[model samples]
Target: MTESVQAWFFLLLAFVGGVSAAAFSFRLLGYLAVSLRRPRDLRRRYGAWAVVTGPTSGIGRSVALKLARKGLNLVLLDLSAANLQETSDMIRSRHGVKTRTVVFDLSLVGTPQGDDSMRRLRAAIDGLDVGVLVNNAGVARPSVAYLHEADVELWVRMLKVNLWALTEVTAAVLPGMVERGRGAVLNMGSASSEAIPSFPLNTIYASTKRYVAKFSRSLYVEYRNKGIDVQCQVTHNQPISRPAFKFHQQE
Candidate 1:
């Protein structure tokens, strides 16, 4: 082609590309603006007695603090005694709300009565009405780069903690919530469950989170009319990761 003709063709292509880019940028900016302007109050119509697992740090800590400030009695659980105590102290001192701590390994798949550590946890706090249950205890591992490098038992244990333990505790508290005809179950799930990524090693952990999200949604559909609110928080951004924090389903 002639130089003049080629130059004109390239110019046209650049113009189209610029227009497309500008359109995308405008849309993104508008979305961000709307998100920034929206109100974020929890909007609870009734009071609660909240239970938060993995309340030692990060999102769990924030959730616990928020509930405490909102005047909800808090039950904070973690495997770390120091962290659990710290959370309890913060809530009691700062918010002046009632706070209880249970430092037992919840990754084990049963009630506290079945295990000595858990029994102590139960014995410490009993005959109380728990209105909101936050099943937020979870972990990912020592970087299993290869399938063979992964410990099958450890993987199962993680599932037992992430899935089964949460289930048991919720089971223990659920009947009460139903009997009262009002309560909330907040499950901390991961966004990896929604869009399956190609990352190796984190597959099993991710799958467990996916199960949590699915379970929470299914429960909501079944029980929302009964005045029960089941909220699953699927977080995309974590403290250790480079992504932004968001929930798949937020109400």
Candidate 2:
């Protein structure tokens, strides 16, 4: 433990931590700027309609509102029919934009009910020009636990929503976007998914989001020539953390 060696070690650690902090800060500031400036003009660039899943609350609600403000008609989906109608009506009243609501639970995406919901979802978006798809529906564990101690069924439901539902929605939306020859898909990811060193307490959840990131990147490359822009946004509850390693995942 010589003084010079210790000095170099501390410097190296600081460099790594600073880089992570810088990335977090950059993403936070960029998001705020985009939200405030509303400079993208998504409707003009994409098409007349956008479909946003889980639109009843949280990030989904915010995204739906912003898209409406940008002058894009909306197709809002959520598990609760009541919530769906509430959000839809609010958006329509506030923005004076057309809104359609569909109640579909992403966690039950493999059952008969889910199949029916899928068909209904397809019918809902059939003829319109869906220029943007926001895969914002998601779920997470109610309580933190190690993998071995986790409840199996709960984890399975999370997977169905996070992976299966998002994938199916993307698949359904892509054909129309391809035919129109222009669109964008935004898949939501979490900070737990390799956005940090690791998410040890939330192992399975992190892995699913990592899959989202990988799936999005591959799709971006696959469809870029086809006029499709697919992007995965990794988010943290706090845009900035005090200690630089407290980035927590959002549901």
Candidate 3:
């Protein structure tokens, strides 16, 4: 082969490698920045109170604790009243931050029971300065059956809980934030949606998370000028080296 051909081949290879490296570097730095930022910034910029859903376990519980440590009062929501009480007590005891619990079941979106829960939630935060909202309550079908294998009811229930519930809860808190003109809204998204080429068995879950990403982007554009910072955190259940505070709109 001619030297000119060899030179062009190496140049193309170098260009591709450089682009890939830069993309990865930016992603790593993004994670590092989120892990390093002080949590107190949320309270200082937004308000004194924050609301977190599904605070009884997992990432929700972690986020609740982090916000509490930042000296923000917490409103905890979960399906189990006992679990909510337990988490609320722990937060209060550990951080000495005021904590309130509301039994919230995101799955019952269209039912009387869910409506009652919404009413209670509204009452709980009535007339309070709620500035940070973490919409973390989500559910995935327990089994890994293919879409056709599962009953239609199962997918419908997942939709209600994962997508509709988050939207309803956000709408509930967002107006209050708008009136106050300063707030931060964080939505829990999934890595299966945009990060991967395909998610075989978890189709509905991935679709709902894609919805979350789009919803968050629209909210960011609509409300950023109004002093609201909307962020969608695309996360995976797999372990990671850094904290899961990574957000789409932060950088």
TM-scores, all candidates, are 0.72, 0.80, 0.86
lDDT of 2 by residue, 1-251 (tens): 99999999999999999999999999999768655763666776779999999988888898888888889999988999999888989999999999887789888898999999999899999999899998888887833788888888999998999899999989988999999998988888777775587888787788888888889878887888888877677664432111111112354
Give candidate 1 misplaced runs (Cα > 4 Å): 1-46, 111-126, 142-144, 236-251
* The 10-residue segment with the lowest total lDDT in model 3: 242-251
lDDT tens digits, residues 1-251, model 3?
99999999999999999999999999899778767876546676788899999888888888888888878899999999889889998999999999888897888987999999999999999988999999888877844778888888888988998899898889999998899998888888777876798788888888887888888888888888788888777654321211223432210
Better of 1 and 2 by TM-score: 2
Which residue pairs collide in model 3, if any?
Answer: none
Q: Candidate 1 on 1-251: residue-level lDDT in tens? A: 99999999999999999999999999899668756874333324323577788888877888888777677788788888888887798789998888878777876555444376556556544666666777877877635646577887787778888788877777766766777777778787776776566556677777887778778777787767766778666554322221112332221
- Candidate 1 clash total? 3
Model 2: what TM-score?
Answer: 0.80
Measured on C-alpha atoms, candidate 3 has an lDDT of: 0.82
lDDT of 1 at 224: 78
As a whole number from 0 to 100, the lDDT of residue 58 in candidate 3 is 82
